[model samples]
Target: MSSTRFTDALTRLVDALPEPDDFPSTARNRELTARVGTWLGACFLLAFLTGVWSHLAQLPDPVLPLPTRPVWLYRVTQGVHVAAGTAAVPLLLVKLWSVFPQLFRRPPAVRRAQVLDAAERLSVLVLVSSASFQLVSGLANSAQWYPWSFSFRATHFAIGWVAMGALLVHVAVKLPVIRTAWLEPQGQPAQGTVSRRTVLGVTWAAAAVAVVTTAASGVPGVRRLSVLATRTGTGPGGIPVNKTAAAAGVARAAADPAFALVVAWGDTERRLSRADLEAMPQTTATLPIACVEGWSASGVWGGVRVADLVDLVGAPTGSAVLVESLQRVGASSRSRLPGNVAADREAILALTLAGEPLSLDHGYPCRVIAPNRPGALQTKWVSRLEVRP
Candidate 1:
C-alpha cells in the first residue's frame, strides 16, 4: 500500500480503541502534565549524574581518581541514583497518562507545524523507551536477576547516555510550554469530583514512600525503614557478600592450610602466610563497599596498608597493582588497581573485619578494599598482588 494509505489505516486502528469518558490526557490537564514533566526531568538528571559517578568509580582508569575521604561518598551517590530512579517511575507513568490523548491528536494544518509535531512525538517515544529500560533494568540489577543475555553493566551504561540525550531534547522542545505552566497561578477547583492538585499530591506521596523504602540499601542508619532493601548490609561479619566461597569455587583454595598471599613488584616478590600477613604492621580503617547493586555497609577493616605491601616488594609509591582472586571464573577475578588506590593509606588487604577474621566470602586471608571503589572491584579471596612500576 502507499505510505499515506498505510498511515491512515494505522490511525484508524488507533482511534478505534475505546477511550473512556474520563481518560487521562493533556486535554484533561495540561498544567498537571507540565508539572509532572518537570519533576520527571529532575529525576532523570539526578540519576544520570549519580550513575556516571558510579560508572567512573568502577573503571580501571577513573575519569579522575575518586577521593578516599568522606568515605561514604559512593554509598550516598549510588543510593541517590537508585532512589531517584525509583521515584521517577511514578512521575513517568503519570506524565505519560496525562499526555495519552496526544498520540491520536489530529495533525496540524500547516506543514511546518506538522513536521515539528512529528519530531516531538518521535523524541517522546525515544525518551519513554529509554527511560523505561533504565528504571526496569536497574531494579532488576538490584535484585541480582539476569533475565537477559546482554551484560547489564555495559548495556545499562550505554542506554543511560541515550536516555539523557533524549531527555535534553525533550526538555528543549517543551521549554516554552513548561515555562508558561510554571508561571501561571494554580487553577481554582474545576467544580469536579476531584482536583488536579489532589491527584498530584497523591503521586508525590507515593514517590516519597518509594524513596524511603528503597533508600535503606545505601543509608545504614535508615535500614529499618527500607522494606524493599535487598541487601541487608548485615551478614557473617557485619557485611553481606554477593558470592560465597563455595559459590565462587574458592572454598578449597581459600581454606587451604598453605594459603599465602604472593605480592610482586617488578624484580622482587614476597609470599606471606596468614600469620606472616598478620605479623606485618597492621592498621585499621573504616570503609564501605558501596556496591553497584545499591547496598553498602561500613566495616572496621584491619590489615596491612596496600602501600605497605607495595613498599615491601620494593615498589615505589604510586605503582598500580594487579589483584588476583582465588575464584577461577568471573569478570572481576583479576582486577587492576590504579596507582592512586595502591598508594592510599586507607586502602588495605584486609585480614579482619569488625575485629573478627574475614569470612571466606569476604576474602578470608586477604582482600583488596580500596576507597571510593565499587564492590565488584573489591577483589575477594585475593591470592596474588602483581605490582607494576
Candidate 2:
C-alpha cells in the first residue's frame, strides 16, 4: 500500500539520525554543560529582575516605588543588565556547541515518551529563539540602531517573559539529567580531542574578553580601549542626552522668557521664574543619567531641593509629585516621583549641569535630577510640579 510504504520510509529516516544514547556520556561533557548553563541561568535571573524593576519604575502609578537612596541603583542595575547580556553571547555559543552533538539524537519510540519529548523540544526551541532575539536586539539597541518597526520595549519585555518561562520549563525537563550529572563524583575527564580544562579555560577567556570590550561605556579609563563600547562622548557640558530639545519639540517653550515653573498643591500654588529658582538656596548633587538604551553620563547638578520646592506649595511631608515637561508629546513627557524621590535632599530640580546653565539638549531651564531613577523618568524642560499625593 502507498500509505504504508510512506510510513516505513519516514520511520527509516528517523532511525538514521544518531540516538541520544549514542553521544559520549562522559563526565566531562555533562560537567561542562552544567557549569556553563548554571552561569547563563544566573545572568537571565539578574537581567529579568532588573528589567522588571525598570518596567515598574516607568509606570504612571507604580504599585511599588524603587528606592532613591542608593543613588547608583539604576546605574548599577542597568550596567549589570547590559554586561550580563553581553557575556551571554559567548556563553550561549559555547553552551550550544557543547550540546550540539545531541541534536542528532533520535526521538522516543514509546507513545507517551514521544509526546513528552516533543513538548521538551518545543520548549527548547522557544527558549533559544527568544533568547537569541533578546541578545541581538539588545546589542543593536546599545548602538542606537533599529531595523524593526515594533516598539522595542514592548516586544523585548514580552519576549523576555516568554524566554524566562521557557527557560524554566527547559530546566524542569532536564533536571533529572542535571541532577545525575551533578551528583556523580569527580573523575578523570574522558579522553577527547581537547582536555576539559582547556575547553573551560577558553570559554571563560572568551566571555571575559566580550565583557571587557563592551564595558568601555562605564569605565572612563577604558573608553579608548573599547571600540565596541556604544556610548562614548558627551552632549553638552560633558553630559549626554537621550532626547534633544529639538527632538522633543520643546525648543520654543524652553527658550521663552515667559516660561515659569508652576508648582502647585491642593490649596497653594507658586510660579517660579529662572531668577526665582536661582535665588533659592541651591543644593548640589552628583548624579548619573543612566538611559534604558544602555548609555550613561554623570555631572554635577545644582538646583532647588525637591523637598524645598514641595514645601513652598505646602504639600505634606512626603507627598508624591507629578512632574510635567515642556515637551508636547511622548509618554515620558510627564513623570511621577514617589515620596522617596520627593523626600531626598539629593533629588533636585536642576537648573545647571557641570556649573553651566543646562544646555537645551540637557533639559534646559530645569530637569529632575534624582538618584537611582531612569533617565527617561527624569522629566526634562520641567514646566510644572503637582503635589497630588
Candidate 3:
C-alpha cells in the first residue's frame, strides 16, 4: 500500500476505537495522563537527539572534531542525555498507569485487524523493553560494572534505534488521542477542567529542574558538589581502589627507589627492567584523567611512549605491552604489565601526576595511562613490562 493509504487506514482504525470515556477513569485522570505523556515524549525526544549526537561523536574520523568540542559542551550534552533518560522512569510509570485501563475495553474488528494488532503489540513490546534496558544498563554502566561482555556503546547504539522506531509507531497510533486531549480541556465530574497549557508548563519546568540539578551534581565542571564524590572507595566489584589511592600511588612512585615505573612489551617469559626504560627517550604530557564516573582531573605524566619503547625492543606493531605494579603478595609480584598495550598509540607507564611524583594511591612506582580507555584498564604499581604479539 502507498504511504498515505497506510497512514489513513491506521488513523481510521485508531479513531474507530473506544475513547477516554469508555475507560474506568474520570476526565481529569485522562487529561493528567495526556499531559504526563506529553512530558515523557518531550524528554524522550531530547534524549534521542543528544544520544545520537554523542554516539556520532564517537565515530572514528567523524566530519567534526568531537573531542575538541568544548569540554563543557560535551558535559552538558551527556548530562542531558542521562537526565532525560532518568526522568523518563517516573513519567513512563504515570503514563502507563493512566493508559492501562484502556486495554480492558474491547472494540469491534476493523480492516487489517491482524496486522494492526500485531504491529501495535510489537511496537509496545519494543518500546517497553528497549526503554527499560537503556535505563537499567545506563545506570549500571555509570556504576562501572559491565554485566554484559558486549561493549556498552555498541549496545546503547543499537537499542537507541529500536527505541526510536518504537516511539514513532506509538506516536502514530496515539495521534488522535493526543490531538483531542491537546485541543480540549479534560472535563470530568469530580475534577474541573485542567488547563493543558498549565500542565505542559509545569511538566516542562520540572524536567528542566531535573536536568539542571542532575547535570550540576554529576558533570565534571560541577561534580565537586555531587554527593557521590563524598562516597569514595565504593566502586564496583569491591575494588578497594579509589581516587585517593590513585592519586597517592602516582606521587609516591616517583621518589621511591623500590617503585618501578616503566612500560614493556614482548613475551611474558622475557621481562624488561627499569634500566631498559631509562635507555629510551622519555616524553612528558600533561593529560587530564577522565573517568566514566563523571570525575576528571589533570595530571602531568612522564614515561617513554609505548610506541617508542616497543621500537627500542624492535617489537612488532601489534605487540601487547605489559605493565607491572610494585605491590606484591607472597612470592609473586603484583603488576599490570604484559597486558594489551598495542590498543593505543599513546599508552604510557606514567611516573607523575599533576607535575609531582606519583603518590601511594595513584600507583606510586608507576601506572599505565591509555587515553580514551576506562581507568581500570590503566593498571597501577608498575613492576615489569612484557611484550606479546
Query: Listing every candidate in turn, what is its Cα RMSD in Å to the true structure after a full C-alpha superposition?
Result: 2.7, 2.9, 10.3
Please report the candidate that would top lDDT against the real structure: 1
Decide which is better by TM-score, 1 or 3.
1
Worst 10 residues of 3 by lDDT: 330-339
Best by TM-score: 1
Question: How do all models score by TM-score?
Answer: 0.93, 0.90, 0.57
Candidate 2 lDDT by residue in tens digits, 48-140: 887877788687777777778688878878888888888888888888878876677677799999898788778888999998998998888
Worst 10 residues of 1 by lDDT: 19-28
Off-target runs (Cα >4 Å) in candidate 2 are 1-28, 185-191
lDDT of 2: 0.84
For model 2, what is the alpha-carbon lDDT of residue 246?
Answer: 90
Clashing pairs in 2: none
Ranked by lDDT from best down, the candidates are 1, 2, 3
Which lDDT tens digits does candidate 3 get at residues 282-324? 6676554444434344455776676665665677765655544
Candidate 3 runs further than 4 Å off: 1-19, 22-81, 90-101, 110-115, 140-165, 171-194, 218-221, 224-284, 293-298, 315-347, 359-361, 379-389
- As for lDDT, the candidate ahead, 2 or 3, is 2
Give lDDT tens digits, candidate 1, residues 17-122: 6554436432347688888889999999999999998888877767677777677888888878888999998898888877886666777899999999898889
Least lDDT summed over 10 consecutive residues: which range in candidate 2?
19-28
Model 1, stretches more than 4 Å misplaced? Answer: 1-27
**Residue 226 accuracy (lDDT) in model 1:** 88
The per-residue C-alpha lDDT of model 1 at residue 111 equals: 96
